[model samples]
Target: MTLPGLLSATVAEAIELVGDVRAVRRTLETLVDLGLGYLTLGEDTPALSGGEAQRLKLAGQMGRTQRDAVFVFDEPSVGLHPLDVRTLVHVLDRLVDNGATVLVIEHDLDLIANADWVIDMGPGGGAAGGRLVARGTPEQIAADDDSLTGGHLRRHLGG
Candidate 1:
């Protein structure tokens, strides 16, 4: 198990006290939220994937008390498992809940479905598309017959 997962599994209820156990556990929870529970704490930074490193940076930002901050991520789910992507979505949700504006340029169906709003710009990528092909909640996007993204979303949503 990763250090954060191990620490969380052995919280104050099962572990001996050192100092500020709550703080330690809170930090571990943050790590888990960023999907770092699946990665070893002692792991080398160079060994981390783009997505993992982005999540690490995101976790650092979570410590700030700043509200109304804009957090933009470009394909942060690049190398994550779907389960880890779910965890990352939850972390993003928390940022939104805390009054942060979260914008994710993602292609993951799960992430798209969870978004409050989505603006899909493509009949095709670069040189072929720039006009908005679809814009709305995932449901609306899925219902759009002209959208390639909508077609995939329909299947992803099992509709």
Candidate 2:
């Protein structure tokens, strides 16, 4: 139904399923605390600022105990201020460290620079694009002449 309602229901179900109300309550409290700064859980689909929504979704996924699923995120940094972007990056890194393959489609160079593996699609943005222009560590991408991503990345790094 509504966002808050959905979140509440999901949280309740999770608590019941896990049979650990204390742990679930603690986790929910942590999420709410985090949300207090950037999100407003509304009656229907919380009126989340872009970054808050992204972070909340990510937190929910990270809270899962599953270890072998492929997680895909599209522009996870869409509305974050630079500071929040850094926080989001750290969260992603933690997820990777915990044994998950994260595939993210993003245009934020800073975040891309920290990725373990980056697959850049280009030559151009639309009908003129769709091929892999570069794929490597941030350094390799920065040094490659064939990649548009390299130029922007190099500039950002002042290389």
Candidate 3:
């Protein structure tokens, strides 16, 4: 359903409306995975948190034929619980498995650690710096003593 179509129903209500259809039930499962089982589809779109919006978009892509596509996300882990973040990771993994290339601009350590490669920018944020401080696999970044990301990653990696 479109946003206007959903304006009167909670997601749970939408699921009930469909009555035992596998696809609708899977959507509720996706919402729960994203820590959004409590959402009313009637809620204003602009009121959603960043993580909520990102996950909603992901939900839309569910079961689609995806290949040769590039998906970009900015700070998708924001406002997500660690467990929810794990769910988000699985979604991204599925995208890759379906042959999409995913690029995420993020600062969350778990997300960063899970990346196959990383480009860490800055000696400082904004005008204070624009240099590429490091670029490597997460383990390589963690080994760079001068990178701030390295320090946090080191701790996260327990190294």
Candidate 4:
């Protein structure tokens, strides 16, 4: 759906459609209360902060009836602060817990750290980089010689 259309739905309607209305409202209100900022609903498509967009997308997915489908998400953590990153991770974990296979392409080390398995593509960034240089748990990947993500995660994990 269009961004504006997504935004135009009342907080209640949006919540009800995906997951649970009551639960979603509680979640959204908590974010707003925490000063994440206002969510403006516009005529065509509402303007959304990057974090807001990501959260909405996730919520929609959570509400879906489809099962056993591979869900590929590109940089799903794009606009969140560290705390929100944790929240996003929890949401994703819930999806995995519910039996969904999630493939996420992201640079955020924290989110990457939570993956059941990670496929890190690089040695470099372009044509030379599309190759898979690493694949494993966050711990295993952190020890891989060819993984750039390994170093970043190692530092983050204090290894």
Ranking by TM-score: 3, 1, 2, 4
Question: How many pairs of residues in model 1 come into backbone collision?
Answer: 0
Model 4 stretches astray by more than 4 angstroms: 1-38, 43-46, 49-54, 64-66
RMSD of 3: 3.3
Top TM-score: which candidate number? 3
lDDT of 1: 0.80
Q: Write the per-residue lDDT of candidate 1 for residues 1-159, one digit (tens) a residue.
A: 445665444222323332457866666667777767756544678988877788878877887864979988989999888898888888888899888998899899999999999999989988998989989999999999999999999999999
State the lDDT at 79 in candidate 4.
69
Root-mean-square deviation (CA) per prediction: 4.6, 6.3, 3.3, 6.2
Candidate 2: the clashing residue pairs are: 3-45
- lDDT string for model 4 (1-159, tens) is 566776776554455444545765776654443324334434223566554665665655665654686777777676667786786777677778778888888999998888889889888888778888989999999998679999999998899
- How does each model score on TM-score? 0.79, 0.74, 0.85, 0.72
TM-score-superior candidate, 1 or 3: 3
Query: What's model 2's lDDT at 59?
Result: 65
The TM-score, computed over Cα atoms with residue i paired to residue i, of candidate 4 is 0.72
Ranking by lDDT: 3, 1, 2, 4
For candidate 2, write residues 1-159 as lDDT tens digits. 454554555433433344556866666554543332333233244665555566666666756754787778778777777776776777677778888888888889989998998888988998989999999999999999999999999998889
lDDT of each: 0.80, 0.71, 0.84, 0.70
**Angstrom error at residue 77, model 4:** 0.9
